[model samples]
Target: MCAEALALLRQQEPWFVSLAILGALYVAAVAYRLLHTSGLALCLRGPKDLRRRYGAWAVVTGPTSGIGRSMALELARRGLNLVLVGRDPGALQDIAGTASDTHGVLTKTVQFDFSLVSTPQGEEAMGRLRQAVERLEVGVLVNNAGVATPHATYLHEADAEAWVRMIRVNLWAVTEVTAAVLPGMVERGRGAVVNIGSGAAEALPSYPLYSVYAATKRYVSQFSRSLCVEYRGKGIDVQCQAPLYVDTKMVTNMVTRGGLLSRLIMPTSDAYAGAAARWIGHRRPVCMPNLGHRLQWCLCHFVPDRALAAHRLRENLRQRAVFQLLRSSSGEGIGGRR
Candidate 1:
């Protein structure tokens, strides 16, 4: 009976066999992604569990606003005392107060501008930052601080000072701060490092107008992956959290103009933070907190790179036009007032 069944199958069709094999492979790939790659595998741990796994304290840079602020608050909720780092002392104090009051967790603030890297002031700030994290038992270091171009433009057209500042904040800060905190984590033999990257790093083919920003984020993802490989058995989980977008002032008008679909797809910072929290101790080298972003990443691979690049270029061109119009209108209004 088995021989007869095999004979009948072999007699049937070659295309059918090929299609069946392809279908099986696709199913397996999907299962692996769901079980290991995506956040679906992440099991959210409570404060007690988190403390046991990571440590008592977590340090978050850019904690004054946006995703940084939300992640800091969420960490506090999970019972980890916080060391909040940001440029605004007032904003830092406010978040510290809220975290302490709401979660009954101790909080400390470190106010320093990352864009000052080329100056004596930057050196002084780095000294202070080093001192801030030295004595504390820092379990998790959230390298969330970053900057982007104010207006989309080619490298030549971009403001020279702003371009340099973006590099200092986005790339320099991550490297310096991580180097400062990593030694302690290594010595302790258990910790987590969460580098907040952008989907610009890998989700699309190429980011044209935002070249510097994309390059910096690519650095972050690579840095995280290499660190994870180097420190795996030592009990340190270095992972990059790269999300597409969240409603935050950093994005300005682009995020605000989105309708209901945008609101749902690109979540608010707080919502994104909550979802991101699930991967705190997750072992993956990267995490896309939003499901929409995960799907976008997967879909981008199916399209041609040139097509994706073309689409991005067109979108960026539209944005540049709109921004120029707004600037000109504002200038005209000011002249009229004069």
Candidate 2:
């Protein structure tokens, strides 16, 4: 076996050398990015640098809960004022007040429902949203408001209303919100745009049951990349962060029932948001800021697509079972998507 392997290696010596060189370059590039965007990099920057680099004010949607809320607080902690957007007026107000009290940063609330985005009135609302922010020196825009399927459903059997809402929140909101903020950033010649996506979109092979949600996330990744290219030299940075599960309400059910591995894999929303914030000035078009998530992203590239698909299918089935059990035990119906 050794003799035959040696003979084959000699025959493909040039090919092997080329592969080795490519692999080395790939490793070097990844290492550089990892180090540059790591938590250590964040430590090197002063709070004043964040305010200066991204601007004085940051806009965050879905700022009432989950990763969105955590990210908003992170920005406030960095000494940036905040524009908090969400459907709930009271919730938005509460967060705004908290940010003001805790971080001593200015905060404003914008009440808007992404669910109605497809309606004419919703378009007008979005227009107003854009108009409202166009005058502000908005430095950072966090397009974090999004909806995922409540549970994995086959595309053929997916609920139409759910589909529309998910699309409106996940895809349309990103476009509208970014459009709302981009022009101001361009005018000022400096800004950062963070589009929050999911691992399902960029890391997994194919999300079989959550097809539409995954597709929307993929669109976010692609959109962020293209926008970055368009604005790269112009001084605006666009980034899509495709993260794995975070300890948010969206995954509360899974987190409660999942094993140790699942819990370990999903960082708390605060943890994930802090890591993501560190990557803002890294200039990378896409980021999976969590070290564990980065490893998963790399492994998914090497794994066979079909095998990954099978594994996802199995996981979806398990999640479905859990949902069914919860529904049966509690009189409450399915939970809303985040």
Candidate 3:
């Protein structure tokens, strides 16, 4: 009887250990999924109406064109005072003038190259911005300046310096501006931040040339969520808006020459801007402009790695075809003059 019992115990031990290991993995995966899903869900919720309780000012970077310009216009329409930042003094002045004349709101234009935000001069520039807004009672910050590069084989080959510049503008500049305004907002107990992220941050396919850009955006996605968590209870709202290809000069150029695939996924910048405005007012942590994009994100969350990779490869090929067509229609080959 004792010998028989020992044999049974030995057999059962292996099965028990295997079960334990499987259970541990399952728990870990579930925990990770839950955390990721929850964080992002929070980002999708829009900003609270702190404006009614406390009148607000909005600072928008890259306000010269595209979504940034649209956001500036929308904010001004709401009777929010504006501090418009961009590299083009002429364009910035134009935007400020339009906002002031049309909306009857105070508008200040600061001309500086946000591409240099990681440098000492950039720090000084930001300081000047702080001084400019010191008396305006700023309550909202929009980090919207960004740039993208055409695809390249080697990451180092695609103007490594420009990649660094993009990082400074897209990632570091947002961080600096947010940090600068945070204390003031916190002290006042009311503020909001809107970070413009890319749908490419979802890690979908056919963005070989945009790997670095995507990676930086992914950082923004995570950072925005984390900031939301840290600042939610303090009457501060941090939100990220990720949109698919917008019908701005950038995407217009891409689509005109790019193949059919580019046309299929192209979205309008105004649409994205409108969605962002609504989300900001609502205090959503993150907003996806397109319903299709939301579904894609959901699918990516649970799909197997191998299957996802294959799907992305196909999409890349389609995108490449569109890019090729765009180049041809523009009367140039790839790498030719625009």
Candidate 3: Cα lDDT at 193? 87
Pairs in steric clash, model 2: none
Error of 3 at 266 (Å): 3.8
- Could you give candidate 3's per-residue lDDT for residues 207-285 as a string of tens digits? 4556777888887888899999899898888888887766675554343435655433554555556556666634556
In terms of lDDT, model 1 sits at 0.82
TM-score of each: 0.87, 0.86, 0.74
Over 4 Å off in model 2, which ranges?
1-48, 255-263
Report the Cα lDDT for candidate 3.
Answer: 0.73
> How badly does each model clash, as a count of residue pairs?
0, 0, 22
- Candidate 1 clash pair list: none
Off by over 4 Å in 1: 1-26, 43-48, 255-260, 330-338
- Residue-level lDDT of model 2, residues 231-318, one tens digit each, is 9887999999989888887876654546766655888888888888878867788888787677677778798999999999998878
Better of 2 and 3 by TM-score: 2
Measured with C-alpha atoms, the lDDT of residue 73 in candidate 2 is 95
Sort order, lDDT high to low: 2, 1, 3
